[model samples]
Target: MRDYVDQLKEKRICSECVGEPYLQDQIEESGQEAECDYCNQTGRTFTIEDMASLVEVAFQQHYERTETQPDGFEYAMQREGIREWEREGEETIDVIGEAAQIDVQPATDVQEILADRYAERDPGAPREVEYEFEREARYTPKKHDDAEWHTKWRQFEHVLKTQTRFFSQEAADTLKEIFGSLDGLKTQAGRSVIIEVGPGTEFTAFYRARTFESDDTLQEALEAPERKLGPAPSSLSKDGRMNARGISVFYGSSDPIVALAEVRPPVGSKVLVGRFDVTRSLRLLDLSALQEVEAHGSLFDPAYVTQIKRAKFLDRLSRRITIPVMPNDEPFEYLATQAIADYLATEASPTLDGILFPSVQAGRGQSNVVLFYKAARVQAQDLPEGSRITASVASQWDDGLEPHYWVSEEVPETPKAKKADQYAHFFGWDEHNPVTQDNRDPSLKLDVQSLVVHHIAAVEFRTTPYSVDRSRIAMLTDEENRTGDVPDF
Candidate 1:
């Protein structure tokens, strides 16, 4: 008998041996039957190694028969250095023991096996998969009914973050033309600058007049003057246009100034005698006035009160000037009074390389003089014969004065182009002045020089508004009443 088998036989009696004090007492009394626990009373003997195998088999059977896993199954597997797995497609079990692999049949519980393996490795950590509902719920769609409120907020943010300093390249060019330099512009990195312009109207004029052989009406001439933006270059008059510099004077009204002054030739040059024409119209409008027109009226003839009101011309002129213009970024009002003050200061303390005039006022429909550092002039033959738009003659005035008329035409929207158009329109109107006659002989061919004004003394800005009185237009006929002094032309 194997030693282990003998030990087991001595420990317990066979089931077939009837009990007395115990199964051992029955075994002792009957001595006719010999039994072994390992063989189930077959009376077979086994080697020690065989007994150990039987013990393992008995324990495995107990583990399988239990409704739940044994409490120490994972611990015992780890202690014994054993690992269990199922064959890929079969019910047979493969066990990896300390030194070799063993096969056990019909133990194909993969999930349970994996659970045991995880439990052994992690002890008490969770073995089932978990999900976080709140984390995923964040991406769910939301509903809201206040769309207008949202839009308002969006607009607020847009203006705050993006609208402050952003403007188009064209806008910058226009601003530079006005300020005489881009160094005066304020901006942020990678952002363009927006210029908030004040509402006002500008009037411009030219000295010499021209007539085109093909066309007679002033429309072609009024529209023909090309805008000269930026500083006046030396080549400005290369094509035989008017070119002049130093200070220049401009009258604010549309009335013909030919009777007052004439463009005389250089001492030895040809006499440049031509008509005097003055064109006036609306210029830039403020932000508020840029909206759709409230009423439709005549685009010409300011004397027609309906047209003036419909276009909001007076309202735009009355708008307050509050935007910054200088390179120092200071807000300034372009009042005629302030302009005179600034001129005084500039003159009192002149800088060697600074602007000579130092300041110019952008008045609101006020009669004012412009100081041009450089301007050019040419004879009538070099330009087109401009068109003339005639309004009803102002006949309600005193009989001694000549009848007055308002000439209107479509001018460019820009300050510079509109000024150029105004200049071209009046080029030849001076010679045609009904009340004035040219002193020079009409047969002499003439060349002209630019109209020049030496100082602010040449400018005469009126504090009172332009006379809407047709009678006043006729009444103001005398030489002194028309233009105070001859501009240096």
Candidate 2:
């Protein structure tokens, strides 16, 4: 017979004798017919040895021994001179009863059984030491060494900013691994980051804004506003959050207000905003959706601990990619994101055309988009051959009323091709032609009716203020304070 059974030969626990519903059910289903010692009633019962095994398993999984404190005055002083201390844990019997939700008598009996077992292993060890539930420690998984992967990103950024901007093997390898891993990640809702967007989709249109300081510039833009407001040509292209110098990419927003805010127009300047329709289907990586990437599994699984750490790192990385960068820091701070954008556009599998990210200027409920050079081409309006077009803006105001501004387009009559000739040319022309005015394919069409002009009268700022505190200090030499001590010279 087991030692516990020999020690408690007269004690047997039944399902009805235990308070925990799960433990009660477990005993009732697997226990044998015997009289319960505690209740003094005949029913299904488990031997004391069997009950001790269950208690031991629970202790191993949920309890940890408290550490012993040092015997020193300094340590005691730090603890506020409280020298006499008990272990920071619950009573052994109370812990066992509460953990299994068993009645006091049965819990005490189980505690005695465990105490005897502990004594058998180490005869000189104390049997009264308290035990704490490993709640905090269990939740804090062992740290996985992710420093190598994290250092890769920092190294890549450093190389691009200081050493090599054009070609760096370290940057390329790091980006390849990152993109490869991200490509397989999915949102908690099981949606891929690469989403299809265009006509008849949730993201059907994008808005771009431009600011003008003078009437001449505004008028010049109105003449061919589609071309003027579109992505700038390589010669005029400047560095941006996701595009380096000489690299042109379309930067727009889902919300017109966000688009206007992004340009940061001066208080006295005029801003023109236009909506552009997504002409066809395109693939874009949505960075905001990365926040929902899930890392969930049973706590018992060792592999899940590493996954949780990686998921946390990914959450931080997603924030870093989209966080706003100040204007002065853009030159260096944008290198990492710019490199990511370039790689996704040219080298990523399935060929992404653009990226969608949260708008830092407008905060939540707004999103910003960037279409790479290949997908930034805007379609020009089709007009009759030799047709002359002119644009005019009119602003009128009545007394005590706000001024209203509007634009009008005028077209002059021109020669037209015959219907038969037009049809013949359209039908006979080859689908593939090398000759073209613009080498790139069009991906966006301007929605002329959605144009609006905003006159900036004031700028608003949101700020947090801190009060300044001041203190004064004075220094004196022995000579300056020698009223009674001149002998010291």
Model number with the top lDDT:
2
Reference-based lDDT, residue 443, model 2: 93
- The positional error of residue 68 in candidate 2, measured at the CA in angstroms, is 7.6
* Pairs in steric clash, model 2: none
lDDT of every predicted structure (CA atoms) = 0.27, 0.74
1-489, model 2: which lDDT tens digit per residue? 366436684578888877666567767888899888888899988876687777666565435555555456647765895555544656677777776667877777776666666655665655454333222111111344446557777888889989998777788877876676556667798888778889888999999999999867777677667767878866677999889888878999998999999999999998989999999998998888766776654332335445655566666677899887888999999999999999988889878999999988888878999999889988876655544445555554555444444455544475566232222222222224444224677999988778888899998877789999998755456775775443332
**TM-score on alpha carbons, each prediction:** 0.17, 0.65
lDDT, candidate 1, 1-489, per-residue tens: 235333432432233322112223323544344444333565323322232232233223221211123246765775677854211211112221110111121111221232233345655655343111111111111121324433433443344344542333433332222223212222223211111111232223323322222222222323322222112233232211111222222211122233122221123222211222222221211222322223322211222233323234222322222232453322112222233222322332211111111112432322222222211122232333243333332346566644333334533344332223344223322444554322321111122122211111243443766766553333444785678754443
lDDT of 1 at 179: 25
For residue 70, give model 2's deviation from the true position in Å.
Answer: 12
TM-score of candidate 1 to 2 decimals: 0.17
